[model samples]
Target: MSIAGQAVGLFAVTNVDDLLVLALFFGRGSDRRATWAVVAGQYLGFALILAAAVAAAFGASFLPSGVLPYLGLLPLALGVRAAVQAWRHPVDDEQPAERGGPRVLEVAAVTFANGGDNIGVYVPVFATAGPAGTTGYVAVFLVLVAVWLAAGRHLATRPAIARTLSRWGHVLLPLVLLGLGLAILLEGGAFGW
Candidate 1:
């Protein structure tokens, strides 16, 4: 796949749950300032996740070549864990009540809290991507964040859509994560890559 295509897949797979969370926030957002703050918070939180992944990738570059393929296990384990969690606790339609107006920090905290899986998937991918590929992935991912926010906001009032997402997101996420893990493993040992 092309870099943009890969980025889109990675971002979408990882952020399916984020759509619901953002939709919830957007649903409650009456103030322009809070809305923009949520957008800014999303960017800030995602940027931090990307940065940490990049840093880990950089560090991983120094490791032995044989160790690279093993990195795939991280996402695989996460996928299994997520699948088990979803099986154990099925999603309900209960939505979060809007507290007061959410600030940048509050939204950022939420965004960051929700990003553990992103960091796990990104680090191994970035580690293999090298400099230019990493740049392309980051650029595409950042652009997609705005698109995701817009889509979420647009879907906010649609209860049917939200309900569908709540119903299926858990199942879809584990599948995506499992596929990503398999891809990484299959494409592993691309030494010159």
Candidate 2:
């Protein structure tokens, strides 16, 4: 695929769940500052994820290929943590003011936790891309992140959609994270056990 195509594809595929998470955050009626915090947090988290992918791509020469597959454990562990947290706190009843409507760290943590696919997809693209292509992919991804946030924010204002997401989003989120982690393990051939 062309660099642009690859970037778009990766952004679309990796961010499907983020849209829901963002909507859930926004549905809580967070103040503008808090909402922007979520955006900033997501950017920070995504930057970290991309940096790791780029590092892995560049450092592939130094590491044994088998060791790279084991990196899948990171997301698997994150998924398990999220699932446990959800199980313990089944209801999200905290007021927006009380918890500040998705703190930056919370959003960042969730973004990173749910980023197994982002890393998996980005590493291969970064590996194939020349410097110019890598730059193009990064640019595309950054722009799309803004587009995604806007879409999620807009979705949050829709009554039916927001209600549906608020109702079932938490339940689905853990499952999605678990699935993403399992997929990474299986796809990377890290499931030798």
Model 1 C-alpha lDDT versus the unseen true structure: 0.69
Residue 32 in candidate 1 has what lDDT? 88
Q: Write the per-residue lDDT of candidate 1 for residues 6-34, one digit (tens) a residue.
A: 99999999989778667655654547886
TM-score of 1: 0.62
Model 1 ranges off by over 4 Å:
60-99, 158-193
User: What is the lDDT of every predicted structure here?
Assistant: 0.69, 0.69
Candidate 1 to native Cα RMSD, angstroms: 8.8
Shift of residue 161 alpha carbon in model 1, Å = 8.1
